[model samples]
Target chain A: MPISLPPPSEEAEAENTLAAIGEFGLIDRVTAGRVQPATTLLGPGDDAAVVAASDGRVVACTDVLVAGVHFRLDWSAPDQIGRKAAAANLADIAAMGAVPTALLVGLACPADTPVETLAGLADGLWAEAGSVGAGVVGGDVASSPTLVLSVTALGSLDGREAVTRAGARPGDVVALAGRVGWAAAGWAVLARGFRSPVAVVAAHRVPEPPYAAGPQAAKAGATAMIDVSDGLLADLGHVSRASGARIDVRSGALEIPARLRDIGRALGVDPLHWLLTGGEDHALAATFPGSPPEGWTEIGVVTDGEPAVLVDGRPYAGGPAGWDHFVR
Target chain B: MPISLPPPSEEAEAENTLAAIGEFGLIDRVTAGRVQPATTLLGPGDDAAVVAASDGRVVACTDVLVAGVHFRLDWSAPDQIGRKAAAANLADIAAMGAVPTALLVGLACPADTPVETLAGLADGLWAEAGSVGAGVVGGDVASSPTLVLSVTALGSLDGREAVTRAGARPGDVVALAGRVGWAAAGWAVLARGFRSPVAVVAAHRVPEPPYAAGPQAAKAGATAMIDVSDGLLADLGHVSRASGARIDVRSGALEIPARLRDIGRALGVDPLHWLLTGGEDHALAATFPGSPPEGWTEIGVVTDGEPAVLVDGRPYAGGPAGWDHFVR
Candidate 1:
């Protein structure tokens, strides 16, 4: 269980609001003493940042997260939210078989938001970026009634062909790296007002994406790859449609962790549903022509058929296999 | 004057809301017929976008615009808002002496928003980017109570060194490119509830930054440079502090536009004040070692003194030189 800290004192709160120090002051506070990697030719404190793209190509993607829609302050700390935002975009770069170089953030929040919260968010962003040898090179901030974080991650392809969804062949083996269903289980636990299973809850707060698996898969001659952000079946559906192939997941292949099984038993639900339909674990899912490299588990296969995702040669019974922003 | 558009019919509104079509549906509609520039190796529908960065370096920047804070739907159309957002970020890239290659957007809005409005915004972003041979490479959409647009622009320096704010030397000439104070005048007209002066209002809605001038200045051996987004003096203050030099603007060199003078006389506010303190015009300000290149007007000189920006060798009587987001 997460230890709930005491609320800040009145004096501390008064002195730490964004409005108290103004935009420039807040910028200085957040960016001060941060070290950037060599890839950042020029970091913040300028009109723009210059990042090295030695291979003559850059991979880029953007992700937006809102307060109530993506996370709640009561459920996760500001740092966790920031890490999640950065991870989501970085995974996209990795999915393209590129190494992350830098990130640019556009943050909007109410003026009265605590400076400490913004600082923590910045720290988390830096820490996560640093993990991949990338830098938070530049950003902009604005005042808004709702908190919104927009992160754009840039990566270097290093002269390799980008692994895309369209490359999956009919005779490819589907494989996955990194955890799945943990975050969804955590969500279920939190929704039921229970936080005792700290592992699941922590997974929900910050994902451990198999970032290295992306480029490794590419080097290992993987044909297609995608970071599973919207459940395994839903994301594979993308590959199926793009490559004009059919994908079928073998139910016997996916190993359900004991922790998740116990939670599912207690909740009177099947853990298989979570394994197949849950999202936000940011696992790397790929199609390889041969046996996948070590660290990747074979879970499915691609074949010449009507473009669709099937489970054991049939459709899954679980209702709605993924999260749709507008629908749910 | 901006033409008053008729409100959408109830049927049209109901049929076009974002929730009605869903996320993937909206993505297909907006990106279907659009053509991407040659710089985009892999466009939308992929996990990430691959953009050419042939110069071995990429310039990047992000800017966020909020519904009520940075823009008002009543004052500007969705297309105009999108154009402004794109232009703001692209201008930052230009200020770094780079040619824009691509853009990634992170848009958050209420689920009830009309798809027509969102399409218009995408069109505007595409139109503005296309003007400079750039493309909208990738983006994300999310649901939120407030509308937020976060745009990240990627650019190529073509092997030229970036003109940063920390390179101005004593005795360097300060030059400017593009209009100053026009957006502020337009903002003032809008604030006063008048819209007949279409030029100013349009300027306020969409800034016309001199994109080519940045590279021109860099090629001409500019020592330092910045974008005039936070008023001339206020931005100059940044350059002054960064370069550790005093900059003195010769007030006579700044020619206040006749239209602005007329509006100023009518509004009982001095045009000079607007020229000195206006923000968001996205003009280029640079310090050159010698006589500035063609299309740039020399308006000030950098000198050895305490780091500060002065007008006519003294601080202007204006209450404050620029905008502070939190302090209004």
Candidate 2:
């Protein structure tokens, strides 16, 4: 947990914190030597970057991260925070069955913030953007008391129809891509002072979203899809409301990873709670006509009933508290 | 100066408080009846929106506005703040010679922030986006101690080459497509307690960018282009640095509006300060091969020399300090 790079010496360096280096200098440093894809007609030096959208359509989403609210300096590094911010926005783009192409970021932090921290944040953003073959094109930098990051992701449809939450049909198969409840389990372990594996902690810090599964589901004729940011049951409720179809989850079919089970046991909590009520997993949940595409696990089915989510044909007894921003 | 709308009460209205309405409800209220142009394939109500990029490229940029730092709640209303935020990002898109198609916003405010305030912000955003024939596609909301807004704008190239700052050549005509220093003059008048007019205050709160001028400049064979968020000299300095050429401005050729001159006289400050050092006007500055398009005024010329901007063949001696975010 020590500083990864040597601490800056006041004399060795130019005593240039972010305040001293200033916004323009930091922008130049971050954008230097970065290769923009051919889809980008203009890059970061301009007022805005022009990127190719050959598919004749674009997918867009935005997310904001505030220090002490979405993240903490004591727990997460700047790189992890940046990656998390990008991942959240990218996941939303993926949910719309689009390929991410570009990102725009807005950052606000105190003047005293270390220059290295800002560099690390940029590195993290680029790293995450690289996962989907996208680049950070343009952004604004400003001064604030605490760190705040806001990212907007742009994506292309590649001539595919967008998969929306309202497209699910009755009798469709419900499936999921990527792991679920890992982040919540990881959060529990971190909150309860349990020494889980590094991978679990990393999951909590930066959820690895299923980047390719969305377009793959679209290609395979997915009826509807959404990313699981708010717990599984709560997110399903969105699908049910939008699609006007009842969703019934077969809990017995869930494949709870062994590590999550071990952590749940260690904390004397039920693994099912993590699976049902845990959030920020960034997993892709979709409904298909019959069988799902490869790498998807069957979890439930859509049926004709009131627009509600049920667990094994009964109303879920657990409270509907998932992730409400203003509600306690 | 008092609160314009009635304060929210428990029995006032269903959508009066964000906490009462919830995130999804607020989203529905904001997005209801919004009409997307043909450029958008998929609009709001999904995790992300899909916009058309018919020319195979998109232009993107982002900006952040924090209360007390960027704007004062006591001075500017929520509607003005929203319009300003959208204008700042959209202006960047226009500066890239692209037509804006869509926008994404991230909002963070105190839980006690009235839903009416949020509605006003949305109304302002929609009004500004409507001016450019675009739509607000996706966004995220969270709670914070103060109001913070982040906007990302997307634009289409429409089969034209993107105009970049590096393309200027010696002898190119430096032309301007919008008014300069108006925002700065307005800010001075407001700061000095000289109530000039509502239009002056409106200019300070929300800029009127020349949205059509960028694409028109590109069509007319513009070599390089930029949005003058910073002062003319400083913004042109960016073009000079990128193109590795000297730029000479003829101050006598500048078209200072009579309104600005009146405000300058009222505030007892040099109008040149507003013209040289003032920022946030969001005007279009570009270099043309020959004559600029209609409505563009010639202001300067590109020269062969070290990268620098000069006024009247000499370094400007006025104390025209350009904007720097880190410095107050």
Candidate 3:
């Protein structure tokens, strides 16, 4: 027997449009069903959330996404945008070997925006925060011509020392704990008008950073660490310049995920380009005093030389430079 | 001999534009010379800022400012934008009767933005946060077509009860702790193509919230509270609806600064319009059981009736309706 389904509009009925729903109603809908971790003493519903700083210290970071610039409405759902914003900020805290505790969000959009869309965005933020056992503690709402989301993440170190970009030493092994260039390859596939038979599109919409690996790297005595929001070479270059060391990536040892390669082939682009130049993968890259802990892949080595990045002992420049906010 | 002064630009030279300055250098400049309060165990320069929730809890809020919608580039500088953004969020914390401890900022701008512009924004945020003895602990940077700033503030209650908007009772006295309608009058002068007096113009640029007044009210047994970011009647309406009380305002008793009245005269607009309908003034409004604290002025009384607000026992209907995100 066939089962009857509710009409599409009814099944997806929103109480009111954002204009009709108003800010307070939209906020209530967005905050429902979210669980606050123990670290968050007070969560949503108040003016601000209070988070526990157990070690008497906290780490914080923020990132902003603008419609048309960071994401297109046609390409990404509001939920995806919310998750990506939270992930990006959380990754920064992870890069410092800190465990995320709470997040504060700032959103601006036109009044006519659907309340359901805003709710979806809030759900995405809650989902991403849940991944790290955190909560969306507070947020702000305002009217604007376009959609803009600003996220701030707070973290606790659990008494571990913070790993900075300035501490990589000569002879240290460079290792990575997550996928690189996957997001970039996905972007290339979309940009070049190629339909890839893979999840590259999903990767482009929502990046999955190695949240645990950051703290793990810190626990294992990594000298310096950074999240690969910029391209691999550009991000590693930060470590090189800060530590006054040369970083040499060994191409053969680098791991390029099969999905990325599949997309690269479909787009008629070299996967290596994405690996070297694409950013927003949020992979954790670190320099270790000895062999890194299990699950980390060694891709390069720190050498006592000029502050620069090299591929196979030579300066390589063959792809679009990594993400730069102003220098598009 | 009088020394010749170079152009204003020459006095504030930045070593690099935002793009040239890069993210790290810009961050360093934006965070230089600011001191953090004891409640902030850590400040900017890390992935996230750690603040002390001494009462085992914290209050947090966020607000965003868009270049053209919130403030015009010609009318306000980056510094003013920064101050306004911080003030908006801080006021939310104050509405909860909490003491602000730290701030996180997310900035989006074109790559060509001057480094000095960002520095000035940071300076303004620091200036405002400093007024409340708070610090800016973390932030993010991104590229957008226009300037967008998102700020999140974290606050502590010092083991006091949170004064929500749901506690007003019949026969309670309604009081206010800061100036009303100055910002609206200043905005009117600017909109009407008339130059306001310096004080009025400054009020329009940056609102000075009565920071200490919130905690003081909480200490003096305020029944309910809210900040006046959305005009007097509208914000008071929130208290009335939440607490199930009717609030009646005695406009004669309200302290409308003389500077605002003069500016209203110049603009050929009713000063009461500015006082009753103006927003972004960041004043504190609360309901008390009896007499208010030392500096607070009695503005109205709470009554046992349907949730509504009135002026002198009658409904007021003269000014433009209160601020609404979607509706104009």
Candidate 4:
């Protein structure tokens, strides 16, 4: 057959790989046609980005997600992985009771990676940031054998004092907002070679962190707060240690979601154990001197004692307390 | 040699690895006994750190350093690698005429990495931040096969307007602060298996960016500025494109340091060529309407022409213009 050429558009799309387009070209492709929020005074392309810090204070945090270590490409799409990475850091800013303003990403991947994959990641990051009125202000990309993303989130306190993990008093009530254990339950289902329970599987793919609830709890006189990225009991243990107080969680108040319970029953497991020890849901947990704000459920109370986390007045027997990246 | 153990201190030191100490333990070891500057409203251990952004706006940027791509462990010590990573991001903030206030790092490495290596990296980061009265405010760590560092730097403009790269005018004089070509020369030397000239090799391992000159040039009325991270000609190309003007460099103005000249002679290469196309020294280059600021050497002028960088009124005829992480 004689040599034939595709249309110009088709040829361009076919040539849109990282090595083909190069670093600058990939950057332009990903950042093109994006809209930044008002908080972003200056966006990408410059040496650095300028962002508004209206309260004279900025809240900042970083999270790293490595392929295979944090997620499997076969399990989640590029956009979902990007959203998860962005959510992980943005939730940290929220956990400090601040309003997110901007994010800076550092991506390292193989040279053969597709431009479309990077664009999808950028799209997901932008979508998540836009949900909180923030922007992806600046980032850098380089070549590597493994794909890794480092996301840094910056936020404004809006002139309010930061609700630190050390502020909970003995009389404060422990409350929870958003979902917990759903992602873990999703992981269990997926590990068992079943994907029918779309609800939990989708949860595993993307966490729906309660971003607004953090500021709500702060405005409602929350003494201490944290993002439940580990397990409920494990994260509560952090609050207990930081506040130098004892916490007793009432297991009956957990109330596992119906979907998780059904999946657990199908998988021959107890949903409550997942609720107590599962992680990656990015839920908001806090201590309130009085009643928690709307959307928060009271689950426990802080008591004057040594720093420890107890379930129903005693330690609960569970498989593991929480997730640790490195084995001891 | 009976089966008697050494002292408890010696035993503990020998067992200090990432896997043995775990994630939280490593965090504690690195953060313990460190003093944060006043700009750090809150430091590590919380979900996020609160930093003082005295100005209404904050300058932020991120840079990624990958092992074997950005630096080789055998060529540079862990501390030097950390400083290089931190300096790369901090210089970007300075390029925008901002004073760095804080850094957040995201590290991914093998589980078998030593705690001592991580501590060395943290020490280097802290030392560099302290030089500018800043702090290592927050960071995250994870396990991966390859080591990757993503550092985000946050800075304040001190109420001055940012000197963006798009502001260069037709009648501007181009100037430079800090050294260029030194790191590239050092890399050449190292590649040739000669480590003698300690000066250049040290420069390659750890760059001394003229951070103070950035805000000084801004105060002295620089029209545009950029961090010379890619190469003098290549980075100036960025200024030309961003500002929509042409820059012509007087090759003789870029004086070849005697040390580099000697090394180049021994290697059968022209040091002037290195001066034009070498990168990674993180020097600051800027444009001024009138006389350049003190400590800045004027080497060229911006003219009304197509966006391009020229050497002696013509294109440079030496080698590739700059470095790119991926091939085109």
Candidate 5:
């Protein structure tokens, strides 16, 4: 139901596609004059980029987005695609209670793709990463039928113990920091072929994850943490199983934002369902043994029981809340 | 002339395709029982994997391989594809004279793909990484029409100065370690419906880069270094331009390996051209101030001239020996 939007404009300075510009030439254009943070010792044009591992440890993860499946060119701009890619990977680092340091991109596009499309994508990537003080260090470009972006993010733990999903205790209090249901509501709006809900439509393009909340949660003695990429209930279940605890979320306690409620009301759908099952919000949900930090709203509690997530005191049974990448 | 062999036997213990298995289940199957290296502080699961960076600096790079473009499943096994993906990125680290520590894979494949194929790919990735004392620390799996592997390699400099391609000076001796032209020869053999060169065929599948020679060069006071992925002249040209010096390679002085010569004779192809322009060799080429240490053979001399590559006093005028990913 995504609304038909104009495709990302292909504004090529030269009348040449990726094939005409060639790989090295395209790379030269894509990476020219990009300022890097101090952590980037050696930048692009080298065999490998050298980044300062300030604390002698590196946290790493990777994610990929395939054209048509993860995104439709008709719906998203090149810059939005790039920004989403960076945000998706950086959110993983934040979920680990680490500060993101650098990103390496692996991009594939058809030979006929406009060079400006790649530049716009780079602009989006750099803009999002720069917002969090990270820089793109190295990447590879290849030709393919569809556009696929593979991004790997590196982060530093800053000498603190990494807050993992397996550390949640029975007595821990579950808390959430960041928006939920917004991206899902946005998706619904876009899916319905309506562009009136502009904010929600933009949210569907770029998720604004609360980056600082993760480290703050770690410092606040959070026992377990996870980023809500695959819906709140689904992701919370991960913490439940990993930590061998039962998580009971109070649906009434969730602070449903007024905008999300308004969007759901306009669409005649239940916003609560979106709050529980909406994916890609990238909100931080953690279990704190004591009172949670500021900016985090207490939403649930951990208890001794079978490892599962319960909504309002019972195991909520419905369609799966997480995204299955392989399920069409 | 790819001989269509039957698809890699689908030995999925659970006869389930990627969709049936689901993303989390597929990830578990793909990563189960893989032994990790000491460098992997945290492996898989949770948010991000933590890799030990002993020297306080990390070298990182990423590369993507698309099906039918970078590799063909009909011709090469999944394991071989995984190995090549790991090798390609690891070679970049080796080019920087860094010791590889870990790899993160971002894989996208069709839903109908057999689970065994992914397992085989994982086997190849783990085996290749293990050979270099590295580990597959993390990965993401998604769905796409064509198979794409986005591999990111992380390495530790081990407190040594990174040997960059831009450090070559006039009068430095150029040396090479590892096989050249073998993989290209294998490709040629396969292209012509002739696969008699068994070793060459295997070489084409798995590039055996001189993993040790890179570190040895760094210890031996080498000035500049690069991996021979894009052919000798093409890669050397990178060094030339970066260092602002001309590289003159003596064709007669090159010790053409016997197997390469034999394959060239059988195919009626010039081994020299393959040696000069053949891509995917993954060999280490370096510049040294005086005579290089053991295990490296001097192949050329750096001289004061415009940044370019010369073979026996002439600029190579043949077609590009290096790969251009966008070229059809």
Candidate 6:
């Protein structure tokens, strides 16, 4: 809860919502002394922030998280939502084999939402971005009926070729880094009103993405790469179809982490289902022509055939399902 | 009304809302055949888009707009909303004295929102971005309770120093390019149910910012610049406060555009009031140490007396009248 709010000033603080202090004051509270990486030549309070480029190019990605759809206010705090939103955008940069440099946040919240909440969101944004040596460079705030966060991440390639989904080839080993199915398991635990094992609940709130492994995989000659944001099988399908190849996920090869297994045993659900179908984990799934670099676990292979993702040569049927905002 | 939806194909066209087609399906419909500008090395359908950076740095800005607050679906078409959203962000880039190169959009709409509406929105985005020689490089779509648009624009400094709000000094001439108070006038016309002068009504739906004059003024050695977003006095106050100088606007020297004057005459309101208080014009206001470049109209001068925006050597008395999202 220690978000390091600025020293109390004439501007009204947490007693009232953002409406009391107004937009400009809220912006000041959220952005005061927010740290920036070296890539940022300028930070907030400008028309635009100037960021250093790599290889004469910049990698940019954006994501929007709606309050009711992407997260529940009752279940998650402002810091958690902020971190998740930042992670989602950063994961895309990592998926592209790039290093994140800066983030521009666009936040829309109800007028009655607390200014402290906004400050906490900013704190979480800076915390998550700072962990990866990036900065929250610029931001915009507006009033809406509900909370809507749109985050744009800018990254640098560091003079390396970007790994795309279209590059997977036959005989390539498909590997993954970072934890899988933990966030999904966390969501399940939270949704069912079961709060035992606090880590599971926390995972659902904040996702820890493998940011560095992206550039490392590209360096290790990753043929195809994607951040597993929409289930392991679902996202791999994109790589498979784009590469015009078949990806086979060996079920035995996947090691379900202890927390996921604990939740599965308590709920009587298969942990593998969450591992394969639970999304929002944001782990790196890549296909390498040779050996994968350190911290990567080989879990599958790419083969020349129909563009399908098969688990142990069989197609995976989704479980109780994970988060999909649009589909009813 | 002619939104120019893509030709019907095997995919579900306007028959279904986003919920009916699912998220990936809706994405396919929305992104198909999206045009990319030449600066984009890669466009949508990837984890991230690679945009060409100029002078080893990229200028970035973001803005958030919510439905029913910033726009209304009943009053404006999807295309108009899309164009306005894109214009707002591009205007910020121009305020930085940079050339816009690419945009990343984040959209959150209700599940019941029609696919055709989304497509039309995409068309509007492309049309507006194309007019500026920029591309919609990438975007994220999600479901929310209401429509929310968060736009991030990336611009190129093009080897010129960014003309920030803090660069102005005493003895600089204050100049302006593009229209002022038009959008607010249009909003007033729309709110009052006046039907005459279709141009005013249309202006409320779409803002036309002078995108070219930003880089031109920078090339001509602009001291400070800002987009006239939150009224002339309010935004000018930002430049004045940041630059530690006073800006004096000579009302007799100002020429109220003919259309604004006609609207004011018909409505029996003082045109000067709207000229000073009305916002959302997105016109470029800059300070020039010497004579301003071509197409810029000199309207005021900077003074060393104080850090306040004065209308003919007196302070603006309009209290709590400008755009503040949180104040009801």
Ranking by lDDT: 1, 4, 5, 6, 2, 3
Clashes of each: 0, 9, 12, 0, 3, 0
Instruction: Supply the TM-score of chain A against the true chain A for every candidate structure.
Output: 0.96, 0.94, 0.93, 0.95, 0.94, 0.93
Decreasing TM-score order of the candidates: 1, 4, 5, 6, 2, 3
Q: Name the docking class for model 4.
A: high
**Candidate 3 C-alpha lDDT tens digits along A177-254:** 888888887777666665454477778889999999989999999999988888889889888887889999998788
Candidate 2 TM-score versus the reference: 0.94
Better of 1 and 6 by DockQ: 1
Clashing residue pairs, candidate 2?
Answer: A51-B57, A51-B58, A52-B56, A52-B57, A53-B56, A53-B57, A56-B52, A57-B51, A58-B51
Model 6 steric clash total: 0
List each candidate's DockQ score: 0.86, 0.71, 0.49, 0.87, 0.81, 0.78
lDDT of 3 by residue, B1-328 (tens): 9999875563344345777777766777877777778877656754455667666566777888888877876788878878998998899889888899888888878777888788889988988998898988888787766678889887878888888888999999999988778888767767777665767767888998898998999999999999998898988988998898999999898766777667666667778877777888889999999999999999999999999999889898785547876543
TM-score for chain A, prediction 1: 0.96
Better of 2 and 5 by lDDT: 5
lDDT of 4 at A109: 95
Kindly list the per-residue Cα lDDT of model 4 for residues B54-143, writing each as its tens digit.
Answer: 987889999999999888888988889888988998899899999999999999999988888899888888888888888999999999
**For residues B71-168, could you state the per-residue lDDT of candidate 2 as single tens digits?**
87877888888899899888888887888988889888777677888888999999999999998888888877767898989888888888888889
Task: Give stretches of model 3 more than 4 Å off.
Answer: A1-17, A32-35, A243-246, A319-321, B1-25, B32-45, B52-55, B263-268, B319-321
- Top-TM-score candidate index: 1
How would you class the docking of model 1?
high
Runs off by more than 4 Å, candidate 6: A1-15, A318-323, B1-14, B318-321
lDDT, candidate 5, residue A28? 94
| Candidate 1 residue-wise lDDT at A261 | 98
**lDDT, residue A202, candidate 4:** 85
- Residue-level lDDT of model 6, residues B162-257, one tens digit each, is 999999899999999988878888888878877447786777788899999999999999999999888888888899988999999988767877
Q: For model 5 chain B, where is the 10-residue window of minimal lDDT?
A: B7-16
Better of 2 and 6 by lDDT: 6
State every prediction's TM-score relative to the real structure. 0.97, 0.94, 0.89, 0.96, 0.95, 0.95
lDDT, candidate 4, at A5: 80
